[model samples]
Target chain A: MKGRKINPKRFEIGQLKIILLILPLVIFMGMPIIFIINHAFKPMEELFAFPPTFFVKNATLENFSKLIKFSDSSGIPLSRYLFNSLVVTVITVGLALLLTTMSAFALAKIKFKGRNALTHINQIAIMFVSTAVLIPRYLVICKLGLIDNLLAHILPLVAMPVALFLVKQFVEQVPDSLLEAAYMDGATDLDIYLKVIMPMIRPAVATAAILVFQQVWTNMETSSYFFSDDSMKTLTFYMNTLVNVNNTVAGQGMAAAASLIMFLPNLILFIILQNKVMNTMANSGIK
Target chain B: MAETTKMSRKDKKALKERMKHLKSGKLERRYARMGYIFMIPWFIGAAVFLAYPLGSSFWYALNNIRITPLGRIFSFVGQGNFTQILIQDPDFMIYLVDYLTSTIISTPIIVVFALIIAMMLNMKIKGKGFFRLIFFLPVIIVSGPILGMLTAEGAGSISAIDTQSLTSAISSVLPDIIAKPISDVFNNMITTLWYSGVQILIFLSGLQKIDKSMYEAAKIDGGSAWECFWKITLPNLKSMILLNTIYTIVFISNNSENPIIVLIEESMFSGTKEKGYGYASAMAWLYSVVVLILVGLFALLLATRKDQYEKQVKRAIKARKKEARNKKKIERRNRRNAKKIERQRAAGKITTHTTDRSDY
Candidate 1:
């Protein structure tokens, strides 16, 4: 696992040239992110300052405290929304990882009738914009009697086609000889899936997990469409309502605080699992 | 009687062979069954979630649906909603045109920008991971309402750029329809670039996979860095470009911030009797078709054509084969002519002293 020693390129003056070119873009791209962070910490007077300050002059936690107080005053506390989001995200990510990897294993390794057709179906499913299927998907949820249920959020997002595609590609790289050896030792298909395939394709699973987590965490559609009750809604939905209802000048600080709260989890998760995510994308291109 | 006996022997042999084949395939059949077992959840999920919804959505588009207190009422109105959205709804058409143009304009910019950043990050530079983390931060936090808040607070653009003069100049030169989306792209340049975070990583991974020896070989062969990039790097990364382009298109089209998607959501829950589930379904159907067409067009545009170097090599090989075949053909024709003359001379039809002009 040692790094290669004889690479032709070295860190020289040429490297500084690239740094110069990229430094400006990196700063440009990082501006909004910096702005988001600074905006959240700004006190009321600075938030509404003319010619809007790029950095916070009077940085304080007042906006966050105000946001917490406002939410506490409401009947449904912000904690309830956060709890709901966590539960939904956890269950969705777990179930989606299981279903996607298992299905990918079958499609990639096993010789079966209609396997190509199933893969084709999944590929075509990737092309479907979720908006196109909204009404009927809603109808399906209603018919299943999951309208006010938490399962409504978890079920619809479980079958992710792109995740399946990526994992299946990773699974195909599992040599046939490895599977044969496992089978020769009297292991069943499920055993191989759990012990061998699962261990090897960990990077892909992590990638899929991150994708499903982001999808479920940020998704406000289910709460908006399926659930009519406010108590059952997620943090994102609540944040959105908070920002929209109080669009007055006094509400800007609180809105900025809420945006930061929602953004922090995703940033933290990516920072932790980024290497695995990069590994997964390394094999994602169509061959 | 003899033929019947032979035919019976052949039939029995065929039956025996069939039995052997079936016996040999028993293990494969078991594996196939196991494959189906593993696939059971997906089968059920696809049928219920994907197939049924698609079928019902198409049907919903054709019907006049009413969600009432007692029960849902469905009055079948064939193409009524489609025509209404196509002809009557001004917002739908305008938003559709805007979505199409902006998507077309921004997709390449996003992809190319991603490629440039990826290439920069791929170099042997200091703090590569730090730069990557900065570049990729956008993908994590980019959601509808959050982005809406950011843009509303004027954080979507650089303060230094005078977008007013730029927009004015662009509008003066071009027509209104085309000019508007281009200016919008410039205005939200940061946000548009943010869309490329995932694309940048995708490109970076692809760049890493390109064998370093190819570049070394090119350098040894006296190829300039620019030449090496166009010849070696670009061709190898062609498929990745196509993949990233399609991903960006799908992502942008389905994003919650997309105006067309917001429009559909509004019409779906609109208080008006005319605009409800049925009308929204029709609008979604139209919008998705546009998205699919855009994806198809970009796919076609970036689809890996046969490599130019390989094509030229193939052409040269084909020409050599054709030349060899032509040489053989001429030698055979000369041999035949010589043989014919020798036979004629032996038969005394022509003598060496009196050579015929036809022999030449």
Candidate 2:
């Protein structure tokens, strides 16, 4: 070992390098996020101003007020869309997470014949072309008299390939000893899944939940197809109606405001559960 | 406890009977059977919701799908729709070109930027978690129709800004007159909107597995930070980069809500469905093929890079040892020269004149 001491400046330089590195992230990610907030608060006229206002000198609740007071063709309230999105997304994510976790736990942990076959099946399912299934899915929904119902969206998304893949990756991390101990306690598979496995994989569950919710929330294909009435439209269909059909500045502004508003639920969820989701993905690489 | 014990005995009897019915090694088989049971709901859903329609679409693509007052029906045209796309369509070529160009440029940028951000995040820094969360916020925010709304509203202003910045950077070394028009059109057409969401998440997770000690070792051996990045970080990220690139190309090419697709949908809504579905399907299939090829190429590149990397590493190790040996030899020569001077002084053979000669 050479008789050389570490330079204090090197540590400072490292810190400086970090700050420099983060500067771009802050500029790119942080600025747009701030713009969304600023745009939300600004009055209509200011938003349309030639040189965009980064900050609102005069803020108003007019956009939110207009959104609430307005009604679409079906006379269903805007709250209905919000309520519908929440209900559909919650159900989809919930059932998907539950079924995926159970299957993943069983596949990853239990020594069983045909596990490899099932895993291969899951892999093949990942490459499924949804467009090919779109017409049939619609027909099935129609035949079942579930067309225009929220279950049409919820049920289809519940068998998500990505969620299953993610949960399988996560469940791989669970120590065999833990599952063995639970088995030794004479816990049934159902009891083990609900009580033991569920708690241990909370972070992975959160990631899967976030991802599922985001997918269901943004899903325009199945959800749009179901909503024959404008009133029954999800937020995505509602926003699209403003641009393609309505074609008015006021409508577009309202759509923009509405889109911004719809983002809040997911954004807030992400912010709150972000640490858990990221930590899970970082440590487990599944999320 | 005694009363429950009697009930438990009854339950155990039932369990034993059920196990016997399942049979010998069939218990383990039953566990897998149970696993498949869990998978059953999704499997059925996938069949009903995914497989059936996809199979039908293949049939539909080869036929004429008409939504008449009677109902929806498909008239089999054999290879008619495919021929129309390949030979009869006017704008088909332009559509393919546009799709391919965007795929080639946008997918790589998104993947590469995600990689860089991931690497930077991997570095031990304060507020690292906060940075990651913020970066991933775009995933939640950039919904399909919301993105449409943003696109319609801004008319690609963000893209324009990025394009202009890039063009100017390129133009700084170019001739002025030649640069202006080229720059303007690029500023108008080519924009670098941050391709958001899952791509970012994939990159972030990919960064996590790289060990930190590699960087520490490089630093100890007098590698500059940039050199360490080139030697250590970039090579380790190959698999993630490949994975992300594949994800991006596939996602972008297959993206239904892209601007051009939206335009096509708008036209169809305007009551001109003549050959629309067939056309869209053709474009989609082509896009899929291009993406598959691109991903395949990237995978090949990644596989080959490993062997190349090992060779480079071996060469570097040899070079480092050679440098160390050279330094040791120089040190020994300096020690021998010092001894020679000391001997000259001991023999009194070196006077002030002799000392001046040594200095010379």
Best-performing candidate as measured by TM-score: 1
Query: Which portions of model 2 show Cα errors greater than 4 Å?
Result: A1-14, A51-54, A72-74, A103-133, A166-204, A229-246, A280-287, B1-28, B122-124, B144-193, B206-242, B263-286, B300-360
Query: What level of docking quality does candidate 2 show?
Result: incorrect
Q: Put down candidate 2 lDDT per residue, A64-155, tens digits, no spaces.
A: 67666665434676677777777777788878887788778877877666678777655544544445345557788888898777788787
Model 1 DockQ class: acceptable
The residue pairs in collision within model 2 are A132-B53, A132-B54, A133-B53, A133-B54
- TM-score: model 1 vs. ground truth: 0.79
Q: List the lowest-lDDT window of 10 residues for candidate 1 chain A.
A: A278-287
Fnat for the candidates in order: 0.53, 0.35
For model 2, the local distance difference test gives 0.64
lDDT of 1 by residue, A21-68 (tens): 888888877876887899899998888787767799878999899998
TM-score of chain A of 1: 0.87
Cα lDDT tens digits, model 1, B39-76, are: 99877887888878877888888988788898778889
